[model samples]
Target: MTIDSFTKLYERAVDLQRLMSPFITGHLVVEFLLRKLIQIYDVSLTQHADDLKHARLISLNHNISTITDAQKDALVGINKIRNKFAHRITHEPTLADLKTLFIKCKDAFSDFTDGIEQGLSEIDGAASVDQLEEWEIHELFIQIAYDLHHVYHNRGGDIEEF
Candidate 1:
């Protein structure tokens, strides 16, 4: 095949690399927050808790009675996307696969203002989450992780009566 034919493939590889870096690392940050939350919730827990993987930690995060079903879906969707990248080495996940999770995030976190009609990002481009660029989606993912991190940082954060 000609180099011209491979241009799209090269672009996709670049996109994946750029996106996956944040996706993987951000998932780790969120997982850390979840584990910390669980530990703080139950002080009797040991480092055995650290052995639990991302999904398990998410399951545990659910023990917080205030976490909504939609909120759990965002975490679950993040893990699902992480799994596709981590486990499906040969598979090329598409924007279609990601859009669903973006939708979940939008649903999961309703606190965003500027009105729902304006769509996901505050930055220019992509009027809707479905239209989010590769970079934009990762930005949203990082935001999710950062928001979780802040909750952990805020001490007896707004998540509960604690």
Candidate 2:
């Protein structure tokens, strides 16, 4: 890549790092919210229970059963938020909206992470999925999943399962 492209990529990475604090948090939050829904509605996603693979699949699947309508909408919003913040794709997201989105994203991330952690905790030998020490583990996988999903969907193909 040219120096300009490298610079742009670096700048975009910085912006995403900043936005990720909350975007990731939003993801975690949505997880907890979904669990709460499970508790309240007695909606058991046997397919989703205790499986990181399934959890991730649910995150990317618009038709995933464990996710509620609100959660799905939030996912769509996250797609937009990531594009705007990480790609500098728009000039219209206001500072206020950005701040709000960041905070909400953080909240969602916390909730989702908590739920995932709790679920994983039940598995013998599973490690903690916290942001402080292991952010990259979760962040990298999440980004890859999202990027691949975007590419696959754009090409009119379903996400491949392994």
lDDT of 2 by residue, 1-162 (tens): 122576775775565424355555645644444443333333365345335432453453435444444545445555565556445432333444433443443333334334334323332232322222234325423543344344334444445531
Off by over 4 Å in 2: 1-17, 20-64, 89-95, 99-162
TM-score of each: 0.66, 0.31
For candidate 1, lDDT tens digit of each residue in 1-162? 122456765765565434566667767777766777766666565375688787777776776632557778888888888888786533434555555666777676543332222324332343433344456555665556555655555646455433
Cα lDDT, all candidates:
0.60, 0.42
Per-residue error at 13 for model 1, in Å? 8.3
Error of 1 at 86 (Å): 1.3
What shift in Å separates residue 52 of candidate 2 from its native position after superposition? 18
lDDT of 1 at 27: 79
Model 2 TM-score is: 0.31
For lDDT, the strongest prediction is 1
Where does candidate 1 stray beyond 4 Å? Answer: 1-18, 110-134, 153-162
